[model samples]
Target: MSPSNGIQTVALAGVGNIGSPLAFEFLENGLTLSILTRDTSKADLKQYAEKGANLVQVDYSSEAQLTQALRGIDVVVSTLPSGSDDQEKNLAKAAKQAGVKLFVKSEWGLDYDAPNMEPVNPMIASKMQLRVELKEVGPPIFVVSNGLFATLAFSSFLGSLDAATRKAVINGNSAQKFSLTAFEDVARFTRLAITRLPIPPAGSSRVLRVQGFAASFDDLIATAEQVGGNKFEVAHKSYESVADKQLEPSLEGLIAWLLASLSDGRGLLPQDKLTHDEVGFKPSVDIRKTVETVLKA
Candidate 1:
């Protein structure tokens, strides 16, 4: 059935981190949503079901199941994580066969289309592979290349120093500025694209790059210091140093490459009027603001 506004059903694959928040946004807007999950036993979905979501348990690894789940859906928003490129490829194929309209690939980190930026982890690999496969899909698909989630910079995963009382092991100082987008805002943007973006002409590839805020690593530490109301110990370690200490080659290699690239400014978006105009997002949180929120939480 054709939606009142041209697009009707939206299916979101994967409901972790950004996906969870994004799904909430869609539900809040009173849209018909179909979500794919591996774990029905996970309690986090209780609220989602109460909010009127059709949460389906499907194996991304199985093409038949994905195809069945995608039937009758008009739009597909992939919040699926890395290492699922093959599944995504299969889904895109199914979406095409099912007459899907818009398929958004989950490439929400650094801009893969950037001149110097390179894919480092398995996640990026899966994303890139899906992009290539999307070309052959009968329907139109788009990629949203949003820079690092601002939250990542503050979280331990990104190396927020976990020091006893004095020294924390952090990758960089507070001075290095980077851009970030809030989860809620990402949801709004996704909705806008689904509901408002003008369709691209017959045959064209569309890419939307979004930025939230730009600040340095030092900025984050300073914010933390202000919130904690006390000076914390600091330890500076090079990405190479972190790699040397890691025992696992895969883990170490991935971290080393990411660290070096981040340090080298490979993922840094170009600072220009045209670039900003093209990306079209003004983020809500600055470094200090983000730190305060984290500290309070």
Candidate 2:
């Protein structure tokens, strides 16, 4: 568990999968939380208000609205998707002007700053570009690079061909090792970092690459087999064969880029110098646990 140093009053930009759970985690930690949404009367956020989050209405497109919404906020945690770089940039600009103490960028996936990376979707590239621009901002921004969400991959999207079938289709080999963090755990870590000190100086733009466990896809398959009480068949498909059919053709290029990244072992997490011992974030969920839960589900 990460310690909170009494800093409260934080804001979240996007409150979807990771952000929704993150808001709950922050509330659990007793932080004075607020969320900026397109609509303030959203029924989804009503429960969050009951949980003690001040849901504020903001026109995500307007700079004045965002700036005014963030007037006295101490920290900002942005979970906006990669395609929303423009919104993130606007938020960064506003946070800087508002004298916010910390801003956590919406970099929950791969480390886009890694050297010699191939081009991804233009939108993703724009997000990386936003990081460089944020460096010029006055407040310190933290970039968290947790590989993949175990919950997401285990869901029907990446795991099975169909939800009902529970048939997992692997592109290449199931033996490729990758680091996976649970969505809930990612939220927990984000809240912990939000209320805590900026471990690495804002000038350096610290990157926290945290993961609960690193395991191969074969490990997940075997675990699924054990939990299902039956041996499951592993179907291997070429990236070319499944790229267009399984994924949208519009996103095929991005899919191939991400697949190549996994094949090259870029999906594996590097040995980060800032661990729980150094900073203070140790996620409790592991890939095996995530796999087990998916199987039971």
lDDT, residue 212, model 1? 66
RMSD of each: 3.7, 3.1
Q: Where is model 2 poorest over a 10-residue stretch in terms of lDDT?
A: 241-250
1-297: candidate 2 lDDT, tens digit per residue: 334554578888888988988889888887788998988887888889998899888876777788898888888899987678778878887887887778888888766666635545555576677888877864678888777777666664454333246566777645777778888877877776666654346544777777767777677767766666766666776755543332232455555555655545666777564344544677788756776677667
lDDT of 1 by residue, 60-156 (tens): 7776787788888878888766666677777777777776788888777776667766535554555676686776763677677666776676556
**Which candidate should be chosen as best, given lDDT against the real structure?**
2
Provide the overall lDDT of each model, using Cα atoms, as 2-decimal numbers. 0.67, 0.71
lDDT minimum window of 10 residues, candidate 1: 273-282
Q: Which stretches of candidate 1 lie over 4 Å from their true place?
A: 1-5, 39-41, 118-123, 163-167, 172-174, 201-204, 239-249, 273-281
Instruction: Give every collision pair in model 2.
Output: none
Model 2, total clashes? 0
Q: For candidate 1, what is the total of clashing residue pairs? A: 12
